[model samples]
Target: MADELIFYTHPQSRGRIARWALEEVGAAYETQVVEYGTTMKGEDYLGINPMGKVPAIVHKGRVVTECAAICAYLAEAFPEAGLAPTAEERADYYRWLFFAAGPVEQAVTNNFAKFEPSADQGRMFGYGNYDLAVDVLEKAVSAHPYIAGDRFTAADIYVGSAVGWGTMFGTLPKRDAFLDYFSRLSSREAYQRAGAKDDALAAELEAAKAPA
Candidate 1:
């Protein structure tokens, strides 16, 4: 039956976000782990993603790539999950989701790397600067219960994943805003399950990398 959803990933990669979406939807899927320095560039997988990226899924004969795209697609595909927003809610959904992936992510990465951009907002990068980007997120998250506000939609899946990973990776500022949001997400059973899977696989890879 092809399992309906084929999660092509390297386990420890951004595929964890898509994996979280799958767990939230309670959708059945088959896992295909691609290893780095090896399986990531495999010929068979190249066609799946032109850039040879993980977190791509083949659902209902359509190939979906990019973490946020996969998350949005899966949420809508399986409406039973209630993780998708309606057309009226599209505005907020797209805003936070893409914001988290784009500006927020960039800022987190920049901060983690200690890359200080120009002080002039117009002269700086897409996220302006790390502090400004984090400030935007802090205010937004503190104001809304969820990314889309009120509902825990797939928007949170993307945003939460970013925040979760950012905090864990020591990228974003560890403010109350991030702590509160991460705590809220961590308490969800689906999140716990998805996180456990990512954690276990990460441990497996670490063991594999250790000196024999």
Candidate 2:
């Protein structure tokens, strides 16, 4: 179909976020698993995303990359899913959505790599410092039932995935607020479904790599 949505991802990456968002929006998408350093960087896949990364989607011949952008794009593209923000929810939606994508993502990755910014360098970095960025994120999740407002939206999928994965991997601190937020998201039927699909695929990939 001309409007078919094709999702390219690897089971073990941030692609899980995009998959969860797809499940939430209830979009029928075909998944293409690309191996890192191989098909992911090969000409065909790279043509879709020069970044040579997973978690990209092609819909109606238009490509969307980055998990956050994919979530936002899907929400708007399928408005019937009701994941898109309302006029009142727009501010908080975009605010925390980009906040998680930018500051939270940077802070968590830097912390994991043991790269702490000096006070002077902190001023230059967008997140200021890992500790400060996490503290702010804690407040954001605690302030609302969901990331954007009282209800679940596309923003939650991205922000919740960050918190969920961070806490799971020990990249982000296991604060009560962060734990509570992700707990709520993880219980969602769509989140569970997405997780099952990815987990099964991950197991299959691991099995293929094992000695036969």
Best by lDDT: 2
- Model 1: lowest-lDDT 10 consecutive positions: 117-126
Among the numbered candidates, top TM-score falls to 2
After TM-score superposition, what is the CA distance of residue 43 in candidate 2 from its true location, in Å?
0.6
Predicted structure 2: lDDT: 0.94
Q: Give the alpha carbon lDDT tens digit for every residue of 47-80 in model 1.
A: 8887887889999778999999988998889899
> CA lDDT of 148 in candidate 2?
85
lDDT of 2 by residue, 1-212 (tens): 42499999999899999999999989788999999999999999989999999899999889999999999999999999999999999999999999999998888888889999999988898899998989999999999899888999999999999999899889988999999999999999999999999999999999999998
Models 1 onward score TM values of: 0.90, 0.97
